[model samples]
Target: MPTAHEVFNTRFVKAMNERNYDEYEALLTDDYVGEYPQSGEVIRGAKNARAIVEHYPGGLPQDNIDTRSTRIAATDARWVRTPTFTFVRAEGTGNVGVSAVRARYPDGSAWWVVNFYELRDGRLARSTTFFAPAFEAPDWRKPFVEQREAPAER
Candidate 1:
C-alpha cells in the first residue's frame, strides 16, 4: 500500500496534470502553505492551488521513472504520460512524500524540483518546494568523476 504522503503527492500532481482545480484544492488545508525557496516565494491558502493552474497553462510536461529495486516502486508513468520519467529519491510517510516530477519543456527548458509536504490531520498544512537548475558539469572535474549509466541502461 502506498503511504498517505505518496497518495497525496501523486494525486496532487495528477490534479495539476489534469487541471482539476476543485480536486486540487480539496487536498489542501484551509491554511495550506506552499514555499518556493528558489523563488523566495511562499503561497498560502487553497486559492493558490488554482493559481498554479494559471501559471502552467500548458500543463506540466509528461515524465516517469523506473526502479529496479524490488523494495522501491517502478513508477512507470507511461500510464500517465509518454516517455516516462526518472527519479532521484521518491519515498514518503503518512505526512511527507518526495514527489518525483522532472521534465524539460518543449522549448528545451528543464527544471528539477523536490516537493516537501507537511500534512496536518490528513490535509496538506505546508509544503516547501526547492528547484534546482541543471548545469553541465565543469570540465575541470573530469579527472575526479565517473559517468553515470544512461537512464535507459539503468
Candidate 2:
C-alpha cells in the first residue's frame, strides 16, 4: 500500500512528466502557493501554479527525460529526507540536466515539497521553495568515453 505522502509525490512527478495540466491542477489546493526558482517567480493559488507549469521549460519535452535518484531518506510518519534528483535530457544524446531537492513536511510526511506547505482542511494556504543551479560535468564528453587498458604481460 502506498502512503498518502508517497501518493501525493508520485502524482506530482507524473503530472510533470506527462504535462497533464488538468491532472496537475487537481492535485493542488484552491489556494495553493508555489515558489519557483528557475524564473524567480512566486505564484499563489492553483491558477498561478498551473500557469507557471504551462510555460516552464522542461515541463514535458518531446525528447527523452530521465529522473534518477541519488539519495532518499524518510521518517516513519514525520517527513522524507533530501533526495538528489539527476534530471537527464536526451540522456544518451549527451545533453543532461540535474537538480537537487529537499522536501520537508511540517506535519511529518513525505509530500514531495521543498518547504512547509500549510494545508487547512486539505487546502493549501502557503508554501516556499529555494532553488539552486544544477551541477554538471565540466566536460560533458567525458561521461561517454570508455577507457581501455593496455595488455598486461606476465
Candidate 3:
C-alpha cells in the first residue's frame, strides 16, 4: 500500500486523468475549499469538485482517452517524465502537501504548477493551486548583473 501522501497524489492525478468524476469527488473532504489565485476564483465544497470537472478544456467530453497533460515530477532541476508526484509534507499527522507539477499539454505547451493541499481524514480539505509560465528576464537587469548560462541550458 502506498503512503497517504502517495495515495492522495496519485489518486488526484489518476481520477482527473481518467475523468472519473465520482472517484475524483470522493478524494475531497465535505467542506473542501479550492483557491485559484490566477483566476481570482474560490470554490467551496462540492462546487470545487464540480468546477474542476466542468472547467478545464482537458476534461471536456471527447474521444474516450486520456487527454490530460503528460506529467513529469522531479526534485532536482532536470525534468524527468514520471506519473508519481513529488510533494513535501507539512508538520504533524494531518496530511498537508506542497507539490510541484510540470506537465506538457496535448498541444505540447508546458507549465509548472504548485499546489498546496490540506487534508482532513485522508481527504483533501483545502487546496490552493497556481500554474506558472516561464518568462524572459528583463533587459534592464542584464546591465546590472553578469551574463551566465540559464538554468535550462545547464
Candidate 4:
C-alpha cells in the first residue's frame, strides 16, 4: 500500500506534469490553501487551488515546462516529509527554480497536501507550505589576508 505522502507526491507531480487540474483537484481537500512566498499570495479553497495550479507561471497546460523531483525525505511511517522540486522550461529559455514543500498527515493515509487542505473523515487535514525565493548572487569574493612572519623568526 502507498503512504499518503507517497501518494500525494506522485499525484501532484503527475498532475503538474500533465497539467491535469481535475486530477489535482481530486487529491486536494475541500478547504485548501496554497501559500506562495515570492508573491506572498494565499490561494484558499479547492477551487482556488485548482485555479492556482492551472494558471501557475511556466506550469503545465499553458507551457511545456517540466518539473523534476530532485530529492525527497519522509519519516519512517511516511507521515511528514519534504520534497524538492525543480521547474524547468521546455524551451530552455527561462531559468530553472527550486522549491521545497513539507507535507503533514493528520488522519492516516488518504488526503495529503503541500499547503493547507481540509481532509475528510479520518483523513489528512490541511497543508501549509513555506516557499523559498530564488535569487542570484555574484561570484565576487574578498581577497584572503596573508599572515606576516615574526621578525624574530626571520
Candidate 5:
C-alpha cells in the first residue's frame, strides 16, 4: 500500500490538475478547513473550496479578461508563461504533509503555493497555504551568499 503522502502526490494532485473537483473533495474531510494568511481568506468545508476552483478568476461563466487578470496577478507579479500548474514538492509522514506547487495563470503570471496540510481519518482535515511570486535576488545579498540557479519548474 502507498503511504498517505504518496496518494496525495499522485492522486490528490492529479484530481486537481484534472479539474475533477468531486474526486478531490473525496480526499478531504467533510469539515475541512483551508486558510490563506496573505489574503486573510478562510475556506470552510469541501464544497465551498470546490466551488472556488470551479469558477476561478471570474465567478460567473463569462469572458472577463479584467477579472481574470486581476485574479491571476493577485500575488503581485508579472510572470512569463502560458497557463501551467505543476507539482514542485510534496512530502509527509503519518498524518502531516507539506506540499508545494507552481501555478501559472493565463495572464502569463506565475506564483508558488505552499500548503501545510493535516490529515484526519486518512483525509485532509486542514490546510494552511502561503503564496509567493518569483523574484530575482537583490544585488545587496550577492556579497554574502553564493548564487545558484532557481529550481526548474516541473
Candidate 6:
C-alpha cells in the first residue's frame, strides 16, 4: 500500500498528463489555493485551477471574470498535446511533498517545474509551483566548469 503522500503525488501527475480536470479537482480541497511565484499569480479554489489548465496558452480571459480572489499572470503560455517528464523525482514526508520535474514541450523547449504540495486530511490544501526554462551554459564559465551531458529526453 502506498502512503497518502505517494498516492497524491502519483494521482497529481496522472491528472496533469491526462488533463483530467474532474480527477484533479477531486484531489484538491474545496478551498485549495495554488500560487505561481514567478508570475505572482494566485489560483483560488479547484475550479480556478481547472480554468487555468483548460484555458492554457491564453489563460483565463480578463473579460467578465472574477479576479477578486484569483489573478491570472500567464499571458504567454505554451500548450502541448503531450508533455514528457524526464529526470522525475519526488519526496514526501507526512503532509508535504516536493516534486522536481523536467518537462519537454512539443516546441522543443524544456522547463523545470518544481512543485510543493501540502495535504490536509488526505486532500491537497495548497500548492506552489515554480517554473524555469532550461538554458544553455554560458560560454564565459567554460574554463571553470566541467561539461555534463544533458538530461535524457523521455
**Judged by lDDT against the true structure, how good is candidate 5?**
0.72
Question: What value does the lDDT take at residue 13 in candidate 5?
Answer: 64
What digit string (tens of lDDT, one per residue) describes model 6 on residues 1-154? 7666656677777776555679978888989999999999999998888777766653333355443333233223542344545436777888888888787664557888999989999788998999888777899999999978866332
Q: How does candidate 1 fare on TM-score?
A: 0.66
In model 5, which regions exceed 4 Å deviation?
1-3, 58-83, 152-154
Order by lDDT, highest first: 5, 6, 3, 1, 2, 4
TM-score of each: 0.66, 0.46, 0.63, 0.44, 0.75, 0.72
In the order shown, the candidates' Cα RMSDs to the true structure are 8.7, 17.3, 8.4, 17.9, 6.5, 8.7
lDDT of each: 0.60, 0.46, 0.63, 0.43, 0.72, 0.71
User: Backbone clash tally for model 1?
Assistant: 3
TM-score ranking, best first = 5, 6, 1, 3, 2, 4
- Tens-digit lDDT string for candidate 3 (99-152): 665544433454566788888888888889887654567899988988765422
Clashing pairs in model 4, backbone N/Cα/C closer than 3 A: 115-127, 115-128, 116-127, 117-126, 117-127
Shift of residue 104 alpha carbon in model 4, Å: 23
Could you tell me the TM-score of candidate 3?
0.63
For candidate 5, the per-residue lDDT at 68 reads 24
Flag clash pairs in model 2: 78-108, 78-109
Q: Least lDDT summed over 10 consecutive residues: which range in candidate 3?
A: 82-91
Alpha-carbon lDDT of model 1: 0.60
TM-score attained by model 6: 0.72
